[model samples]
Structure formats: C-alpha cells, structure tokens
Target: MEPLELVPGRYIGEGQPCFVIAEIGQNHQGDMELAKTLRQAKECGADCVKLQMSSLPHKFNKQALSRPYNSEHAWGETYGDHKKHLEFSRDQLHELQEYATQHDIPLTASAMDIPSLYVLHELNVPFIKVGSGDIHNLPLLRTAAACSKPLVVSTGMSDIAWVSQVYEELTIQDPPTPLVFLQCTSAYPSPPEQTHLRVLDTYAQMFPHAHIGYSGHELGIHVTIAAVARGARVVERHLTLNRTWKGSDHSCSLEPHDLRELIKAIRSVEAALGSPLKAFQPSEEACFMKLGKTLVAARPIRAGQMLEEDDLVAKVAEPRGIPAQRLGSLVGGYLNRDVEQDESIMEADVL
Candidate 1:
C-alpha cells in the first residue's frame, strides 16, 4: 500500500518509520499546566501527541452521564462531572495545539462525538482519531471521512464484521479516506493473553489498502515494540507523568522515561528488522574469517583416488577452501593431486 501522508512530509505505511503517538488522553486531569508538560512527548520521540475530545452532551445520554461515578479515581461525583473536569475547553485545546507547534510536533485528538469531530476539523489537526468507543457510530465515521483528513481508528470492543463494515463505509468514497486501522483491546492495562497482537495481521489481510497499526494499553513497552516488529506501521500508547496518578488511563500510560525507552527500542527494532533478504552480511566478515568452517581432508589420499564422504570433515581450515556444504558434490570425484591428511579441500584439488 502507498504511504499515507499523515503530517507534512511525514508518512505512515510500508518503508516509513513507525508513527508513534503518545496519547495524553484525560491523564492531564484537567490541569492546563500538566497538559503542556504532556506535550513534551516530542522530546520522548513521539511523532505526534494526541488527546481525547468530547462534547459531553453530544457524546452521552443523560442517563449514562447521570450515573454516579464514585471510584477512587473520580474527579467528581457523577460520570458527567468527571468527564467535564477532564475535558479541555476549545480555547485550551487551541492553545495546546499552538504549544505543540512550538515544540515541533504534530498534535491531534480523538473525536469522541460528532461535535468534537467538527471542532478538530476546524482546528485543522493533521489527522483525526476515532477512539474505539466511536467505532460503531457510523454517522461519526461518515462525518470524519467527509472531513478528508487522515483518520486513525482504533478497533476495540468490536468484532471483525462490524470493523469490516466500517472500513467499507469509510473507504467507499471516490478518493477513499486516508485511513489507519489500529488493533486494540479496550481493557486498561490489558493482560498479555488478551492483547491479541495477531489482529494486526488480520487487519492487514482484511484491508490491504489501509495502513495497519496497534494501539496498546498493556503495562510495558515490550508489547508495543513487539507490535512494531510484527509489521505495525503506526503505534499508539497512552502517556502519563506518573502511573500512580488518580485516573484510569494513568495506570496503563507510559511515563516519560518509559516513553523514551520505548522509542529507543522501536528505532533499534526497526533497524534490526531491515531487509527480508538473507545473505552473507558484511558485518559478519570478521567472524566468518575467525570461525567459519571449510571441508578438509580427513585422511591422506594419492592422486587419481575417488573422493569419499568419509575422507572429508568440516573444520576452521587455515586457508578457506571449498565450503563445507560442497563436500557432498566432491564425493565420487577423483582427486587431481595428492592431499595431506587434514588438508583443506579446494576446487582445484579435484578434477
């Protein structure tokens, strides 16, 4: 598939560097100052920093919003209040976007509802995110596709049938929306058993035109790095200053140090992934000279004697000779000259 230009000069797809998104989400806890600090994701090597945007009234029904939310992490007594507390004002989001620019990184947000989707469009974010909760909302999906910006959609709390339907709806347009499908499991701090990273392969197979990625809520960077190694062209992980902070996402979010390590490990893995072709590498030349084995004469034989398998052995011969693998071909061939016991076998030594 051709690369999707996510931001100016930044692409996501085959041969491009994995696009890493540090999702700040609601971990800012409604603190504007903390939000700015979280934007430092660029310093930690993220290609983009993302937040979650929602207009509570447009996003949730009254009954759902009114439900009491009294968990230890609650910022308010009701679910609505808690979400409102974390929701950044439109003006605040604009400020953060400008801040991200000064830091030289792209800033984006997941539109939790249609209203917020339009808001992000107005902000001209390089791309728009569709969090898993909105994946089943076909109207929002259509609206996001209509916006024509790159869309990064998380597939969580969803089945393949629904995901396939959504993929069709979004891509049926004339030009087809520039899209990325991220395999995700909604569980916070998702257990390894449920992570189902192989879903990345499924998405790639199911939607060859769309870029495939992984959005991880697991405890460490290992799974995230593994996702990259598994051919994920994009990866998203939540970011937090402290995992012990009073928020649900905080528990699963990567700290600054952890984010740095994750990026470092990802680049290393990408480098190691290299080309698929297998051949002798220049880096191994020294080791090959030091320890590579060759076929050697196991016993002395006079000229005109037929070579025998029993007469050949592999060893680190003083002078590199016909490779050990050629020993089989040498069998039954008459020797052109006398050879000393244990001498390396050369092509010229056989007729």
Candidate 2:
C-alpha cells in the first residue's frame, strides 16, 4: 500500500515513526489557555496537539441538553451548560490556530457537527478528526470526506458493520479520502481487558487502503506503546495537565511527564521493531562469536583415521570450523591428520 502523507512532509506507514497525538480535548477546562497547553504538548514531544471543536446546539438536542449533569466533574448543573463551558468560540479557535502556526506546533481538532467540521476545513487543518460518537453519522462522514483533508476517525462503541459502512462511504469519494482508523473502547478510563488492541489487525486487513491507528482511553502509557508495536502508525492519547483536574477525561489523560515518556517509549519500540527481513545483524556478531558451536574432536585421534560420530562433539571454538549442523557430511569421511581432543574439526582435516 502507498503511504499517505498526513501532514505536509511527514508520512504515516509501516516504515514511518508512529504519529503521536496529544488529544487535549476539553481538558483545558474552559481555561482558554490553549497556547500554554500547546506549548506543553510540544515539550512533551507530541507530533500534534488535538482539540475538540463543536457547535453544541447543532450536536445536541433540547432533551439531551436538559439532562442533569450530577457528576463531581461537572462544571455546570446541566449537560449543555457543562459543554458550553468547554466549547470554544470561532474567534477563540482561530486564535488557537494562529498560535499553533506561529509556534510551529501541529494542531488539529475533532469536529462534532457539520458547522464545526466546515469551520475546521476552512482553517485548512492538517486533517479532520472524527470522534468515535460520530461513527454512525453518515452525513457528517460525507461532509468530512468532501472537505478533502485526510481523516483520523476513532472507532469506539461501534461494531464491524458500522466500521464497514464508514469505510465504504469514504472509499467512494471522487478521489478517495486518505484515512486512519483508530481502534478504541468508549470507556473513559478503558481497562486493558476491554481495549481490544487486536482490532488494529482487523482494521489493517479490512481497510488495506487506509492507515491503521489507535486512540487509547486505557490507564497508563504501556498500552499506547503496545499499540505502536502492533502496527498502529498513529496513536492518540488524551493529554491533561493533571489527572486530578475536574473533567471526565482527566483520569484517562496523560500529563506532560507521562506524555513525554510515552513518546520516548513509542520511538524506542519503533527502533526495536526493525526490519522484517530476518538475517544476521552486526549487533548479533558478538553473541555469535561467543556462543556459536562447531563440531570438535571428542577425543584424541591418530592421523589417517576415518571420522565418525563417536569422535565428534559440538563445542564453542575460537576459530569456527565445520558448523555443528553439517556434522552428518563428515561422518563417512576419513581424516587426513591427527586432531587434539576438544579441537574444532576442520574441513581441511578430512578427505
């Protein structure tokens, strides 16, 4: 499959470094301090910092808005009010976009409604991020695909059929949209058991044309690292300043320190996952020198004696002679010279 370039110069594929996303979704907690968070994400080695963009009225109906938000994480009495506190105005988003451009920090956002997606598309975001909740929103998917920007879609609380529909819709575009499907579980602090990381493999097989990725809500950074090892070219993990912060996503988010370590760990694993073509590596030469075995003289033998199995033993030798694996060929051969006990059986010593 041809590698897709998600950003201008960076490519996403099997050979490319894992694209680490620091999803600062609503964790800014209506602070309007996106610049600070963006800077922190850069310091944490994030390839990109993702924000959440939404037109609340367009996304939620009156009935849904009227629902009481009673959790301790709630900033307002009702769900709508709570979301309003986190929602950024168009001007605010533009300001954040400008800041990201100035600082050279790559930034993108999740679009929850058509209007929001249009706004982001107008801004020429690196890509449009479709949150998991919108997996079945065919209209939104079509609108996003038309935007012509590559997409990073999270698939959580969704079945294979739902995913297939999304894939089919995107693939039929005039020029097929470049896509990355992030395997995710909807739980806020998704447990390891529910992560279903193996689904990444499923996505790879189902959508060979699209890049496969992971968006983890699981606790700790290990699972995120594991995702990269399992062929996820993109990894999205929530990012927050503190886990104790008053937000539903804080507990699942990685703080600056954790984000830094997660990036480090992913890169380390990428380096360690080297080429699939198996052959001798320079790094393994020392091990081969010390532990490689060769057929050796099991006991003292006089010149002109025929070599036999009883006279050979495999052992480590300074100068490698006939390898232990080829010992059968020498069994019927006659020796031309005497050999000391414990000496490697050389090819030149046999007829």
Candidate 3:
C-alpha cells in the first residue's frame, strides 16, 4: 500500500529505459514445452515477462463447456472447453517462475479472478497486472491492490472516467504501490488509430504519482517507440515465437526478432527524451553560436555618420556583433568609423 522503493540503479520513471514487459499471455497455449519457449523472452531483452492466470473452470461460464461451439478455428467446440486447452496447472506455472528468476527476469501475471489472484500473490511476484478484460472487475482489482504488490493495469478499452474509477477504487483504501497504468485496446491486433498515444500525456497529469505505460497490440516497433517518447515509463508487448503460430494472440504478438527490434527502438526513444530542461544543448552550442544571428551592417556607412535603418542586418556566425535589435540604439548616434557591407556590426563602431 506504499510506494515500492526502487533500487538505485533501477529508476522506473522519468529518464529510465522504458521498462519492457513481454506479455506471454496464454500464448504458452497450455504446452509446458511451448511455455518453456518463454525463456527466449528474457533473451529478447525484456525487463519482465508476464502470464495470465485463470482457473477457467472456476471463472468461465460452465454452459460453454457442454456444447461444442463450432467455429472456423481449430480449438474446442465450446468457449470453456477451448480455454481448458489453454490452461496451465500450478506446477507448470511454478516451473515458469523458477525459470524466469534463474534468468534474472522478473515474472508477473494477470489475475482475472480470486483464485487467479491468489495464484499470482503466492508466486511472490514483484507486481501484478490486471488485463483489459478484467478492467471492470473492481473486486479483483481491489484484491490485487490489497495484496500491496506493485500493479499494472491496461486501459485499452476503458474511457477516461472508467480509468479514473479503477484508479480510485484500487488506491482509496491504502495508497497502492508503484501502480503503473498501461494504455491498451482490447482488440487483438489493435489498429494504430485505436492506440491514441496522446492519452499517455493525459494520464501523466491524471496519475502523476504512478508510472504510465503502453500495452500495445499494434503491428510495429514504431508505436512502442512512440509511446516511450510520449512519456511511457513501462511498455507491455505480447511475445510469441512466430506470428504464424496457431494461437489467438500470435498475430499481435512480437516474435523474438521483433521483440529485439522493439527493445532497441524503445531504448533509443528513452535516450532521446533526455531532460525536460532545455538550454543550449552541449553538442549544439558551438553550432548555435556560429550560425546564430548577430547584428551586421546592412549597408556601407562612413565615419562620423549617424546610423540609420540601412545600417544593420541579422546574420550568422560570431554572435559577438552588435545584434540587429541594437540597431535602434545605434541609430541617431555618431558612427566611430566606416562599417562595411555584410560585415558583423559592432557596438564599438558607433558612439
């Protein structure tokens, strides 16, 4: 219920590497062998790897289990039965936790129900994510918040009011930990227009106390990169071995190579965001001084002549000249000597 204390080298907000999360979400497809492929997520340079935990039997409508809901898809007939094929047992999840820790990648999960929440809480995770489907499930959110773990929630399908409601419900009791909000759209393979990266700017003001993130379903590394540029402190991207792989999320998920590209781009964006403070940038100072305008003589003028409108012009290089605006003051004053055309006019040239 308190802000999680971040270690010195690991700054999560502001100018840190946009913390990358590869949401493995059910892409494990219930095969522990396939789940083992998640080891590659860390190899792709993810800051954390996430899973979605749901006791399908407990959480889904049992009616969907009886009838085989025929579909063009290759899965089970009923929705519930289809989910059963995707479910992983407690042991498989435990092995995943161990594997992630061994690789030095923090593993977390989304808890869609109480049992799912219990499973993740028991895993001793550093954070818990609330997937877009459960954004309206305040009870689950309250439970996740009460556990006092750092939380990340996706706001893809949610509106501004709903976003505010979720934040208020979760933190009103005891200010939750470093809760991060991810702008997400529930659509699989979400389109670019739905991303609305500007919301990141809005949330920055709305939730100044927490980290703002982007949970992207878009097709490229550019949106992910732009999110970090827009001030996302965290980025959640789905990961899969191949887009052609037969899974509901495979289409939107980043393959290992794409994931590598994403990390590269986001890091570059964070490096580019730099400091909000702006003065003459170091690499630019010399160029700025050289190319910056300084006052110059507009026309030839002789000694003892009074300055006039034709006497000055703005030009680049050696800003040491009597910059153009000073032309006003230079005017009506006696010229100490002749100033040449195209030459930098100096204050000393006039009395």
* Most accurate candidate by TM-score: 1
Per-residue lDDT for 45-98 in model 2, tens only?
Answer: 888888999998899999888899998988899999999988888888888888
Global Cα lDDT for candidate 3: 0.79
**Per-residue C-alpha lDDT of model 3 across residues 150-217, encoded as one tens digit per residue:** 78888866799999988777666644545888988778888888779999889888875677889999
Q: How many clashes in each candidate?
A: 0, 0, 5
Which 10-residue window of candidate 1 scores lowest in summed lDDT?
36-45
TM-score (C-alpha, index-matched) for candidate 2: 0.94
Residue pairs of candidate 3 with colliding backbone atoms: 68-77, 69-77, 156-184, 156-185, 295-323
Task: Residues 227-343, candidate 1: write the lDDT tens digits.
Answer: 999999999999999999899899999999999999999999999999999989999999988898999889998889988899889999988898888888988988889999999
Per-residue lDDT value at 158 in model 2: 96
Looking at model 2, residue 88 earns an lDDT score of 88
If both were scored by lDDT, which would come out higher, candidate 2 or candidate 3? 2
- Write down the worst ten-residue block by lDDT for model 3: 1-10
In candidate 2, how many Å is residue 99 off?
1.6
